[model samples]
Target: MKKLVLTGAAGRLGSYLREPLSQMCDRLVSTDWTEDIGKLYPSETYVKADLGDLEAMEAVLDGADMVVHFGAIGDEAAWDKILHSNIIGAYNVWEAAARKGLRRVVYASSIHAVGMYPKTQRIDTEVPHRPDTYYGLAKCFAEDLGSLYWDKKGIESVHLRILSAAQVNNPRALGSWLSYDDLIHLVQQAITTPITGFCVIYGVSNNDRVTVDNHKAAFLGYRPKDNAEQCAEEVLAAADPADPHDPGQMCQGGPFASVEIGFSGTASMNIVQDKKEI
Candidate 1:
């Protein structure tokens, strides 16, 4: 591809993806609400754009081949923020990608979209939506929007229902941890695949205790080599098992399920601040 556009370029996850994506195309346009992302990769250009502004998004995505959209509120927040960033931002991305004639949208969906489901269920992409918070509901909306555009128009989409892509320092990480390497591999697969109409794949690693299945998305050639088991002993030893009655523990959404709708669920967890650098 001659050009590719990536939103949320200032974020921790987007920061890591910039270089690798830069290597894949002639020009990698990385955009964020911020003026800069500290530094730039060799084949990258920075753009300060807001996802809520449909015209701004269309301008940035002009002449792009594919879009990797990780631009949104990363956690549970007030309804207004969720509505603007997650909901409206999503609509802007899909509509812009379709109107701009981009090949596909590699979206960052969340396990919270089905977070209310029991952890023991071992659900797959085929399950129904059960969002635990306003944030999760926004993901649900984006997933549905992706499907609608693919069905009505020809724009393709790949919704990655990410479990947890942070450093592994808690028990839930033992089952849901997705290393940065695996996250990159997942996105590479989502964009490079020859044909993908509208797919849903769990964003997880080869964790030994994983409860979600990615077998349906195997054709994408995403074979995660990293596992969270390496840090299992340390993580489990530092944290106590979740209470059976607590949705934060028993449900797939983990901390997200147990928190108040507008409150921060991850604030109480023992997640390590070990942001992996590229």
Candidate 2:
């Protein structure tokens, strides 16, 4: 690919992706609302653009072969904030990609989109959306938008419903954690896959206790290397006694299942900061 555009380039996950993504394409256009990302890799070029601005987003994606869209509120918030950054932002990316004739869009969707399901009931990519919060609703919208674009415009997309892409510091994370190495692997597969016309895959490690199934997305060739079970003992020891009846503890979505609409659920997880340079 000649060029690759990455939104949310100043974020924690984006920081780790920049160097790898830059090496894959001749020119890596990294964008975020932030003015700077501290430093840049050889093929990286920073561009500050808001996801809410369709014209500005189009300008940034003009010459890109593919787009890895990660820009958004990245939190549970008021409906207005989510509507702008997550909902409208998703539409803009898809529209811009279609107009530009990009190869594909790699999206950062979340497990919260199906948070209402019980932990015992393992879900696959084919499961219907069961959003738990407004933030989750936005993810469902984006996933559906990806589907619509692929069916109507022939634009390819790979939506990764990330469970928990953070440090494993609690019991819930033992089953849901998506390690940094695995995340890089998943993104690489999403980009290199030959034909991904609206594919959905679980963004999780190869944990023994995993609640989500990725068998249907085997064609994408996303074989994760890391496992959260390595930290299981420590995490379980640190966790408070879990109530099996509590939705937060019994649901596959963890804290997200118990949170009210527009409230923060990720705040409950004790995720450690990434040590990677941004």
Candidate 3:
């Protein structure tokens, strides 16, 4: 590819992606609201821009072949904050991609989009959106926005409804863990696939207790290598008895399902700040 744009360049997942994406394109343009993202790859350049600014998004996406959108608050937040950063930010990215003639958008969606579903039900990409929080609602909006753009503007998109792309320290993570290696593989497939008009796939690993099915997305060739079972013994050994009545324990969204609309879900998840420093 000639040029590829990556939003949320300062984020944890985005940090891991910068080097790899730089290798895939002749020029990798990374953008974030931060002033700088430290050292860049040989083919990478940093663009300090906010996702809420349509003009900035347009300037950042100009001439890019595709975009890997990961910008936004990754946790449940107040409605106003979610509105500006996640909802409006998404519009700017998609609108800019269409106006710039980008080929596709590999969006970083979330499991919260269907967070209300019971963990017992093995859901798929086609399930209706049942957002658990304002953050999840934003994801639902972006997924629909992507669909609308494909139907109306011929812009292609692949929404990866990511589960838990973090360390597996809890029982719920055993079924939702998506290792960083698998994340890169999924993004690569979403970007290189030949004829994906608008697709949705779970960003999860090949865990023994995996909850979501990805058979419909087999064409994308996303064969996840890592599994959370390796940590099952330790996690289960220290696991607390799950209350069947708690939505956090019974629903696919875990803590997000139980958190208040404006509360932070990641705060209770004990997520490590393991950003890949380049």
Candidate 4:
């Protein structure tokens, strides 16, 4: 790849991706709303850009072969905030990618897009959207927008519905955890795949108790190697038994399923700090 653009470059996940992404392309443009990204790779360039601005996104996407869109508010907040960052920002990305003639967009969608489904039901890539928050609703909209752009404008996209890309500290994480190594592999597959019109795949490790199915998206070649089961005994021991009637515990999205519209579900979980070499 000649040029690759990564949004939300200052974020926790982006910190791990920057160096590897820089290696994949001749030039890697890392952007975020923040002014500083601390340390930079030799081939990596930093830029401050907001997802809400179409012209800014267009400029950043120019000459890029592909885009890894992880920029957003990342939580269930006010509708106004979600509208600008997640919803409008997503449209801007697709439109910009279409105008710039980029090959593909790898979006950071969340499992919250289908959060309302019962945990007992093994959801698949093709399952209908059951968003739990305004944040999740935005993801669903962007996914549909990706599909529209593909059908109408020929832009390719891969929407990865990540379950839990954090430490396996809770019972739900035993099935939902997505190791950082697997995350890098998943993104590589999405970018290198020969053809991906509009694909949706669950971003998860090969756990013993996985609740999501990726059989339909076999073409993307994302085979996760890590298993959260290694930490299952400790996590399960720490977890309190779920009430059968509570949507939060019984649903696939876990805490997100029961949180109020503007509350932060991630705050309730103890996520391990990411340690990346600067």
Candidate 5:
């Protein structure tokens, strides 16, 4: 690829993606609301922009091969906050990418888009969305937006319903964790696949205890090498036994499913706040 664009370049996941993406493409334009993302990688340039801003997005997207859109409020937040950053921001990215004639958009959608589904059911990519929070709802909106664009504008997209892409710190993570290496591999698959009209792939690993099924998306060739199974014994030992009656523990969304809508789930979530700047 000649040029690639990445939103949320300052985020934890983006921190890991910067170098690899730069290596794959001739030029990588990394953008975020921040003034800087610390240091730049080879073939990577920084641009300050917001996903909610159409003009800025258009300018950054010009001449790009594909866009890795991870720029959003990563956690559950107020309705207005989710609206501006998640909902509107997603639209701007798609609109800008389509206008620029980009081949595809690899979106950072969350598993929360199907969080309300029970983990016991073992759902696949074809299942209808059942968002558990405003944040999850935004993912659904973006995925639908990607589909609409593909159907109407002939623009293609790949929605990665990421389960967990951070350190495996809790019991729930054993089934949902996605290693950084696996994430980079997933993006590469999304961008290099010969033809993907509009696809949805779960961003997860080969964990032995997984609840979400990825059999339908196997064609993307995202064979994850890393697995959360290694940490299962340790994590499960320290974690409290899951209550079947508890909606949060029983559902695919975990804590997000039990929390009230428009409320913060970060405090309850066992997420690693990786602060190191790339």
Candidate 6:
């Protein structure tokens, strides 16, 4: 491809994607609201832009072939913040993609979109939305937006309903973790796939205890290598007893499912802030 745009360049996951994505295109335009994302990889450049600014997004996406949209307020937050960053930001990405005539959008959707479902039920990508918070609701909106654009405007999109892409510190991560290497592989598949009209796939590794089924997305050929179960003995040994009745423990969304609307679910997870840097 001639050019690819990546939003949220400064984010933990986006940081990992920068170096790899740069190799796949002649030019990689990485955007975020941050002043700078420090160093850049070969063929990579940074752009300071807000996701809420449609005009700015249009400018950043100009001449780009595809966009990997990782931009958004990551955790549960106030309705106004979620509306501006996640919901409106998603619209700007799709709307700008449509206006720019981009080939496809590889979005970073979340399990929170279907977070209300019990972990016992191994749901698939087709399961109806049961968002756990304002953040999750925004993800649902983006997934639907992607579908609408595909059906009506002939735009292509791939919504990767990422479970948990952080450190395997907690027990839930044993089943829900998506290792960084697996995440890169998933995004690569989403980008290089030939004829994906509008797809939704779970972003999870080949965990023995995986809670979701990805058989429907077998077409994407995303074979995740890492398994969080490797750290299971250690994680489990250190873990406290889980309450069966707590939504945080029983539901797919974990903390988000149990927390109040505006609160942060990630606070309780003790996720290590380890971001890959180039």
Candidate 1 lDDT, 214-234, residue by residue in tens: 888888888998899999788
Model 1: colliding residue pairs: none
lDDT (10s digit) by residue, model 5, range 1-278: 89999999899999988888898899999999999888798789999998889999999999998999999999899999999999999999999998999999999999999999999999999999999999999999999999999999988899999998889999888899999889999999998898888999999988989898888888899999998989978988898877999988889998899998988876788578784465
In candidate 4, stretches whose alpha carbon ends up further than 4 angstroms from where it belongs are none
Backbone N/Cα/C clashes per model:
0, 0, 0, 0, 0, 0
lDDT of each: 0.90, 0.91, 0.95, 0.92, 0.92, 0.96
**Which residue ranges in model 3 land beyond 4 Å of their true spot?**
none
Candidate 4 per-residue C-alpha lDDT over 67-172 given as tens digits, one digit per residue, 9 for 90 to 100: 9999998778889999999999999999999999998999999999999999899999999999999999999999999999999999899999999988888888
TM-score of 6: 0.99
Q: Could you tell me the lDDT of residue 266 within candidate 3?
A: 87
Best by lDDT: 6
TM-scores of all predicted structures? 0.97, 0.98, 0.99, 0.98, 0.98, 0.99
Give the poorly placed runs of model 2, Cα more than 4 Å off.
none
Better of 5 and 6 by TM-score: 6
Deviation in angstroms for 128 in model 2?
A: 0.8
For candidate 4, what is the TM-score?
A: 0.98
lDDT of 6 by residue, 163-245 (tens): 99999989999999999999999999999999899999999999999999999999999999998888999999999998999
Residue-level lDDT tens digits of model 3 in 77-114: 99999999999999999999999999899999999999
Q: Model 1 scores what on Cα lDDT?
A: 0.90
